[model samples]
Target: MLCDNERGVSLGTVGLKVLTSKDAKKVYAGIVAAGLRAKETVLETAEKVQASASDVLAEAQEINEARNEEIFEENK
Candidate 1:
């Protein structure tokens, strides 16, 4: 038998349980905590990627400048 309660659904005698208010609060807290942790992880990865990209751009600029100097010298 399946029914809807004010809080959640009830499935009778199949070992399924409904969330009481307290249990619901705990579940909500857990979900929030997980979301925070995931956000932190994503932010950390983004920072690392940004730093790496900056380094690559700097290196590429240096190489281009060196090549420009070589061409200028050859034309002299």
Candidate 2:
């Protein structure tokens, strides 16, 4: 249902829409787009974290190799 003429508005889940305006539907779509963008940002942050973890693991492996070589020389 639409709002009363006195209010000039409609109920929206995340954003307001003018009751009689052309973009009332657009208003709802914009709210949905905002939600999608927020979700996309979370996914992007997760990808960066995975990349950082892989880099750290690679560095640790190189250090282990050097340490193993040093231990072998000492034993010899």
Candidate 3:
């Protein structure tokens, strides 16, 4: 028997048991929905990671600029 959970319906019994048309449709829909949710999460996480990387790069550039200015002043 297939189990239902908070995440989604289980598909573990797909090949183990024979399913009716209605049950098959439900399984297909669940799979599609899960796939879409996964894609959205990936995109969201990627955006966050990209933004963080940009911030780190900007900070590094600022630090390098400050060090260069200090060296220039010391030489003068």
Question: Cα-based RMSD of the predictions, in order?
Answer: 5.3, 6.9, 9.5
TM-score of predicted model 2? 0.62
Between candidates 1 and 2, which one is better according to lDDT?
1
After TM-score superposition, the amount by which residue 35's alpha carbon in candidate 2 deviates from its true location, in angstroms, is 1.4
Best by TM-score: 1
Off by over 4 Å in 3: 1-20
The digit string of per-residue lDDT tens for model 2 on 14-47 reads 2443544667877878899999999999999999
Alpha-carbon lDDT, every model: 0.82, 0.82, 0.84
- Residue 49 shift from truth in candidate 1, angstroms: 0.4
In candidate 2, where is summed lDDT lowest over 10 consecutive residues? 8-17
Model 1 TM-score is 0.74
Q: Rank the candidates by lDDT, best first.
A: 3, 1, 2
Better candidate by lDDT, 2 or 3:
3
Assess every candidate by TM-score.
Answer: 0.74, 0.62, 0.71
- Residues 1-76 of candidate 1: C-alpha lDDT, one tens digit per residue: 4346623533443234445566777998999999999999999999999999999999999999999999999999
State the lDDT of candidate 3 residue by residue for 1-76, as single tens digits. 4346622434435543556567887998999999999999999999999999999999999999999999999999
